[model samples]
Target chain A: MASAPAQADLRTRLQNFIPKLVLAPSVAVIFLFVYGFIIFTLYLSFTDSRILPSYNLVGFENYSKLFRLSHWTTSITNLAIFASLYIGISTLIGLALATFLDQKIRGEGLLRPIYLYPMALSFIVTGTAWKWLLDPGIGLEHTMHLWGWESFQFGWIKNSDYAIYTVVLAAVWQSSGFVMAMFLAGLRGIDNEILKAAQMDGASNFQMYRRIILPQLRPAFLSAFVILSHLAVKSYDLVIALTGGGPGRATELPATFMYSYTFTRNQMGIGASSAVIMLMTIAAIMVPYLYAELREKK
Target chain B: MTLIKQLKLSAAVLALTATTAAAADVEVLHWWTSGGEAAALNVLKGDLESQNIGWMDMPVAGGGGEAAMTVLRARVTSGNAPTAVQMLGFDIQDWAKEGALANLNDVASEGGWDAVVPAALQRFSKYEDQWVAAPVNVHSVNWVWANKKLFDDNNISVPTTWEEFEAAMQTLQDAGVTPIAQGGQPWQEATLFDSVVMATGGPEFYQKALIDLDPEALGSDTMKQAFDRLGVIRENVDDNFSGRDWNLATAMVINGEAGMQIMGDWAKGEFVAAGQVPDEDFLCFRFPGTQDQVMFNADQFAMFDQGGTVSEEQAALASAIMSPSFQAAFNVVKGSVPARTDVPDTDFDACGKKGMADLAQAAEADMLFGSLAQGHGAPASIKNAYYDVVTAFFNGSFDSETATEELVTAIEIAQ
Candidate 1:
């Protein structure tokens, strides 16, 4: 009687808790492996360590060392220049492509994949292909010579002062298509009546785009900017594959410097300290922009 | 009756399994991806197989060995170190100090390594006088590789001195061909700078500046002359030389687009890969002025201590690495001289013979410099300081005077 009812209640509670029990292992795994390691890296930057991890407390020596090295300063400076140029150019180019595609043009569906194909390939493969294409004696220069233009030179990739720009160009080629897709989605989501009214008012093409469309695409720009900035801050594989931080360290970036310090030089403490500085620098740049975006959304 | 029969059968199976255990499986990680390097590795694979050892081959293809190092570090940190890793120079010491290496003194003693291997190589292969790694091959870094046909066509003989070499480069430049085929990466640049230092300053100055971290030597007039020569090299290179791979630079020489390349003996492997015979298609010479000085490093294997079931197997693998037969076979295919001095030179090619002869002479004269490649010969801070000054000079950011001042500053900071 009363015991039967209590037993039924116990069964209901067990049934209700099964989903949580099933999800516990995965949740705990993600937390421990992903988040735990990040915290550990953060903790290591505060200590002075060398070839192996050390627990000895030596506050800010590694950070000061990071500031002292010319390579570190150059790396941070180059990262900023690369990020700004890459993101700004990519967003503009992506917007233009999205707008052109929205005109009900021929081959729109077929051409979408053509532009996006570069994003599918790994950075290493991208770098190899671009290196050949940009090489002086091999690709473009050879092609020009064949066409009887013997004096033509497209050797920016070989110039120390201009090598980093080539990396930026390769990055833009790979990422602009991704930005275009996002912009295209936003363009498609716009209300049809607003555009119709704008046209009805006999508004000029440029004016209509500037006043109505660009303002509405603020969220898309923010999304693309954040993604590009994140990619730029962590840039390593492409630089390594393409230039290898040379023409005499002309194209060296923070990520590559950190890698060389940690593994190649066996200065784990200095490497971690550089990584911490990079994180702080990124935070300083992104936090205000992120906060404004969140507030605007609210 | 059935239960008794089953129990007897199980006992018999257990007894049979206990009599024989499976052969130990060893996984080796390396960065030898070129055709010639691949051929060289196969020789080692065959030798390992003959010893009843199973090899797990993990090859990462990049000449600079960057990608391979990254993957290795990740595996090691995660407690999954390979049985052996093909390492160069200072990297062995760096890894050993982290308590990851298996001490190989017993194996070294059994193989009589002390009698055959050079004392300079021992600095890198040993930590605290205990053999923590096995040296397989020695690679000399200051070799000048040239296209014999191109030189002959241009009516040029092999230059015997630095001044003559400069004149030859000028002649090649006048003929509208690139005089030097330089890959514009950092390590390649470093290689060129080191060769220049050897050519201009001789072995003693090189030892003082690179190995001893002597600030006074770095700021000397001899170092300034080296920088001036590098400036000449920079002017001679084709406009599109930046970011090129060393092998690709070798390809240019093979195709007759360039006349010469200053690189390590490993360039011989590249030449061989392209189906070019040593004395027929190309010639290997010591960079003219540095003919008496040999700057060398050894490729060695450091075994990591993997606990549990693989412990005994790891020790056996380490022992097998130091065996005389393995060393001879591995080095011959690698296009490098064996670490042991007593190995027969019968299997070596013309270039290998020349290398052996030069190595012998340099050793006898006490003109051999250990390395800046493997961190054992010089401290990392000092090496990087040199790299900074040398790289800046190569890029034309600093002139000879500025470079000399910077070199002094670099050494001061390093000390």
Candidate 2:
């Protein structure tokens, strides 16, 4: 240690400084754009900003007004329905497909990509394609009628009562394949010896899988739930492209509400309040999951 | 002249040409990307090109400039405002209030725009006694485009009152035809509401209920009747109308699948594009009781205040927009009447001629009013508030009385 002089110590310090120098710009950008804008939006929520951002504070007025709107209540109710269905359906389908693939089925590689194809597409494309397919006049219903099935009726997209489910259907179609890949990876990581041991103990396929295999996929389920909940809370483009928050604001989500009020409706204060609420929603879902993840690693 | 003097003159002329070529071109942000609309904009672009002014086009398309407005907000907030922007009524006023719009009084006076433009359009063009925007075209929302064959087959003359219109629709429905080709969008629903309010309550009551958002007017029996009329129209629309685009609804009328569409004059371009002649293949009439009244929405271009003053290019662009010749040429292709009331109608079609005449008469009689559905009668916040109530009423979420009550409450909250 004494042989190491000031020159060596200085060189070591310079080497350590290089990594921070490289990372500083990105860190600064994220802080300014992500956290700084979040703080700014939070600040604007308390102000009476309209059409453009103003700084005149009118604390909690926007929030109180937001809660009073039936439109906001409708959006929150829709979020509850969409998130539950999207997560539930996607997880079930993913697990089933992953289990099927784990059976060492034929053409696994070909079938895997085919199953995952929809995930590769952007949500906008999915929304648009689903919109056409679900339209009664010129899409599936039209084709069915042309096929001489005159009694065929599938107009869920047009029905305000079932429109949110259509959003869920498209979302599930796009994401279930990704979830399958997650489960497939998790299933493959399970030790082959454990399965063989269960079989030797005379455990049937259903019992072994139900008691052992399903319980082992906890992390996958947790991750999927966390990911889907946030995605549901922030869903904007799919609804806009598919339903445009209509046939009478039936499919309006919080993100669409925020964008509409801020830009189209010229109610920036209400928009900002809605946005802050959405961010807090995401944080509520993500923070506990992240904290558990880090604590587990420790 | 000596050789040296001739060379000096030639060099000076070359320098002048270079500077003119290097002059900043006007960058215009607009949402006019449809086929006919783009062609109409080409007329103005060519006009500017003729005067040695270059045009830098910035086109964004979606939701009738809603997406474009979002992009404009981002640009202006970032201090990269376009030289000019295509704006609607209160949007120009909103931007003017923000002090982001240029004062075009210099160009306004030079072109003598005050006398030619109608007062209703001028209401949007000028803010605080200063010209902030140039009126481009006027679109009236009270027109019904009906297939002539269907009307003739149904033995219905052009209905001139509410009872007659309802009777005709009932006849069409009995014949197993969809009576009204309506798109189930909030804005389209509100457009129908505009004509209905004007028809059911007359122009004066419409001014009070929609324009002024008076509590008494909004909650009156007249408002309830408007909702009931909207309910009648709703029953005539097909089940497949939900999430359908406006053009597709127009196509339904053109293809004989539906009887009529109550829409703005923009739908005329669709008929024209389909090679359907007016008063022949299709007939355009003012909604039954709205014959004497016009519900109008005008497109305008507001110049942004770059460097705290209007650039020469911006002034030239604004001047060209209001010129009688350009207005005529543009509106003729654009399926709208000229914003300037003095423009000649020789180039207009049969329907266009009717629109022009109706607009002039309505203006002269003080019966012309802005369309609330199209963001001219009120600001966006209030207009959107009306949209929620109107759509809910049309979709059976609210009865007429509840709709009237909701309308009052919604407007008050928005205010």
Candidate 3:
């Protein structure tokens, strides 16, 4: 017993030390690159940095200037529309597909992959394919006309008024499948007894889902909302590939705005400010979720 | 043990050889990844190779040169700047201001770049009387490319003024051919506006408003007129022009699907690629009323400081870029006129020859202004601000008055 205690003390300390040692490099990397660059960007937002980073602090000038620009305003407005629609539509489509699959439908395996296949493709590919499909000239309209459908029209991609919705379309198409997978897992994890009891109580199918199934899938819905919302906010590639933030900056998200200002527009200070704002937005969504997630685990 | 020793010795030898070989090679960061562009870059690469200098090709493709600039900034900031970078417009100036670019005065003076290169290009090539970049080719942005067959079929002559241009577009529209083949991207919209501004208010107004970011000029009636003309042009563009690449618009003109395209001379590359002959299959004209002025964007190779030492490779690269032979060889393949005035237009097509002549005429008159859309007229911030306004007006997001006001405000805020 004396030997066992002595040996266990060294082994326990070694075990603890080894894991931290193994994790040290990645932790330091995350701290230095992710958090460090974030802090650096925060500092740069207050400065007069342009084209390149300069440390001549100008207080709230960049922030003030950023707010005054209509482009920034447009980007913010687009993000609001894109985020709301992308999250709402994707969650709905995902839940619907998951619910349909959960009914033990025929060819569920084939249909499931087909649904998830779009998610497998990168946003760049989805954006590009959808861009071609949505274009009125060489895309769907043209194809339909060639096939003798003279009155076919799907030119939302070209309409500034509706271009953000097209971005919403492409983003939702890509993310919905993944959302479906999440919901499907949640649906599978539901207790069969709960559903049987609902059936025994003579509840309608819709009522059963509404009363029992839907409430249990809160975690999945939360995850999907969080994931889809962040993806919507940080969307750059899809918009870039599909809209390039145009038909007159109609699809200009905050991410694209930050990139354009920082690298292309040479307004690093404003770009940094926009980036800090985006970080704060993500943090606003992420922090409470993380806190709740960890608190529940504890 | 002996085999290990032998292997270690060979490894040492390989390392020594690699460093020595790399010393003579110039690392070039560029976005010339397209087929024709890469071929044109090969001309310079071969020229550099002929001079016994190696080339480290760093091609970052996307956003025109936006992605390349991002990579360049990261490289420069990390203090591992490439030996040279293909840059455009005020980008060279921005880099030079940061003191990351090396002084190319010695090679420039040796190559007689000051006398041979146009002053408009030299404006970007030099910083504080020091040559920091070497211009490769001049890409003029004010040209209107039209399908000659469509023009002939519609019985329309090449328009020389804004009203006549409108009449021609109307004829094309009535004839059921798409009038203007225009991409709907901000830069493309801004490119059309570049010529429209030059056409509407002439070069001096463009100089005052765009380059100088002058509030009075931006807010003036002339600016509104420019927007009004742009609005008319916008009306004529096909409905599906949004998010279309410049080349696709060019193809619309080439295939006779669209009557005309108001685009840069670079669109000619698409025409050439599509096997359409200029002056026969298509006609390249100055955007109406911009015949006297040239809105240009030049591609230049900017050498980095590299710890304040101008290596032989950097100097050779600069000198090679300025040489008349390389300029001619590169531009002919790249579908642009040579940057050098002295380069003969014998090898150029009809449009290329006209571009060279127009460039010379405009340069002589001090009318060679940088294209605002392509980041030559102003710094990126101001140019982008201008783009926001121009694009907004074109897309019906703003009226002429609102666009003008927004233009002035945006430029001021960018400043």
Candidate 4:
């Protein structure tokens, strides 16, 4: 017991190693399942695969074919429109709700759950509910006609130019709630003394938000953008359930395109290439953001 | 050590799977989850259950069966393939090429399938001169189901030619009726487009462009003319004909809201479920100018290989699928003709009789080509390419000429 310093250092070393050992299993799983499949997908992209994976390598043949496809180009254009509107509008609505709820208002507890309810439902559920509600013959349009408003119509889901926006509508509706919850947490976490101090410094309510509160909520905004963008990139079930990428490929996303090509279209190579490209796009956005966050914590 | 490891793994697998992975449970993957379709499937399920074979239903519901196909791929790649998969057309052949399908040679030989099943179906049933799938029922997509009351009330005679069909559509349109109930789903649009192509240029053209992938035929004026006719048909559709299900379109025709629907024989199941009589409630005719041709798609169950130890239950299931009585019973409910040419039409209704007659005549006349929209005539890539071009054309994104150009380019690239 008295042989103290060396023995104590050994104990500390064992404590550090125990935590790493506990983390090892999960780190190994992530490396194999997530990154390993990614690498497999990259390998499959270079081959002449069809309904099944074939190892007959044709190099960049699949990538070139993917580029030449009008459908692929259409899907990319749709993603651009979808991702922007999805992120921008979700952030705005989320921030607004959070800020409103941040007010010292009555029944804030009841209002918060109602706002956060949509996030509990899966995108598939959201897509199906919205599809029925948006269909012209069945939903609002039919109801309007029944109510003697014969000219009223909301058939944007069936229109190619507008169908992508409908997807954005559903995506934003489902996700804005979660973003609001995050912003709300951030708003609550702000030091109350800062607001008091701002008021004492002659800052108006607007000025208080502009100077003190908004800046403090930067982390929430960053998290919201990152989460929503990742969701946007990998959106498949919603597109499948809502429109099946139809009305002439109007709302086709890269995820749907990849599945269709790989499984149904017998263009597995091109599908794999599209999947790889999607992974790269996500990594490009996420890698820097993740690194910065970790570095800041350090 | 390796031997011991292998033996241990085998023992664990045997222990775990001993209860349910018994030889008789035929795990059949299919996409028939609709009411009438499920009812028809029940007939098969009951038949198998009676034969002491268990039926494991793996229903992945999407009309196109793409979701089920994805599931099948993942299962097969992971070495957990089902006993059988409900596949059709080139899809079966595609799976067969990957060496996943079982050779149903014993069942085919015992059942005399080659003698009873139609040659057109046999083209898909076999790969490398060995039976890989058992043909179940034949579905023709060249039928036009008309609202009998509406047509009769308007004095619209049964149209058997393009001119008459146009006159009928125009008459219905002029009378404030939606002429044709068409869905804007890509496959539905492609279905309409395929019918137009066949109606305009006949089966030979369909075979060349869709089946053979002849670039000349794809880009030719015949293809262009087909697109032109498609444009004319597009005009007859209602304003809200986009993104609707095929059954809903059939419902429109059923309720007299729409004059006619161009769909496969399976649409008859919808009419039947609605309690409509064949010729009394709805009349059937070939898509105009396609009277000589029957655009066909057949559903078959391709059994998975058990590494040369094919089970008796699998063989029995294949034989049962091809049996004349089961075929007749299944097809009667399924709204398709039996794949076996020998199955009598006594149980069939008027529309069914007409389908059988047209199928017979088309078979004799050598005009019974498989359907492109139904994944029969070509692989999915080429089929989807055709769908893209045709749908874009139908949606007014492309004219006849540009549609032709794009169609050629797409098929060439896909092929």
Best by lDDT: 2
Per-residue lDDT tens digits for candidate 3, residues B84-117, read 8999978989888878888888887788888888
Per-residue lDDT over A137-231 for candidate 4, one digit per residue giving the tens place of the 0 to 100 score: 78889999999999998988877778888899999999988999999999999999999988999999999989899999988988998889989
Candidate 4: clashing pairs of residues: none
DockQ, candidate no. 4: 0.54
Interface RMSD over true interface Cα atoms for each candidate: 2.7, 1.4, 1.3, 1.6
Question: Higher TM-score: candidate 1 or 4?
Answer: 4
C-alpha lDDT of residue B97 in model 4 = 89
Please give the range of 10 consecutive residues that has the lowest summed lDDT in model 4 chain A.
A241-250
Model 4 misplaced regions, further than 4 Å: A1-13, A288-298, B1-21
Instruction: Please report how far candidate 1 places residue A107 from its true position, in Å.
Output: 5.0
lDDT against the true structure, each candidate: 0.80, 0.90, 0.87, 0.88
lDDT of 2 by residue, B1-415 (tens): 6999999999999999955653657888998886667878999999999998888899997545778898999999998898899998888998999999999999999989888889888989999999999999999999999999999998989999999999999999998999999988888999999999999999889999999889999999999999999999999999888767688899999999999999999888888878889999999999999999989999999999978888888888998998999999999888899998889999999999999999999999999899998889998899898998898777766899999998998888777
lDDT of 4 at B287: 89
Candidate 1 residue-wise lDDT, A18-133, digit = tens: 98899999999999997876677677777776656788877887777677666676688778778888898989888989999999899999988888788998888887888888
Each model's TM-score for chain A is: 0.91, 0.95, 0.94, 0.92
Question: After superposing candidate 2, which stretches have Cα over 4 Å from the reference?
Answer: A1-8, A289-298, B1-24
The estimated TM-scores of all candidates read 0.87, 0.93, 0.91, 0.93
Give the TM-score comparing model 2 with the true structure, all chains together: 0.93
Residue range A1-298, candidate 3, lDDT tens digits? 7999989999999999999999999999999999999999999999998877899999999999989988889999998898888899999999999999999988998999999999888888998899888878788899999999999888788777988898988888888889999999999999999899989999999898899999999889888978887788888999988887888887899999999898877889999999999989888878998788758756
Q: What CAPRI grade goes to candidate 3? A: medium
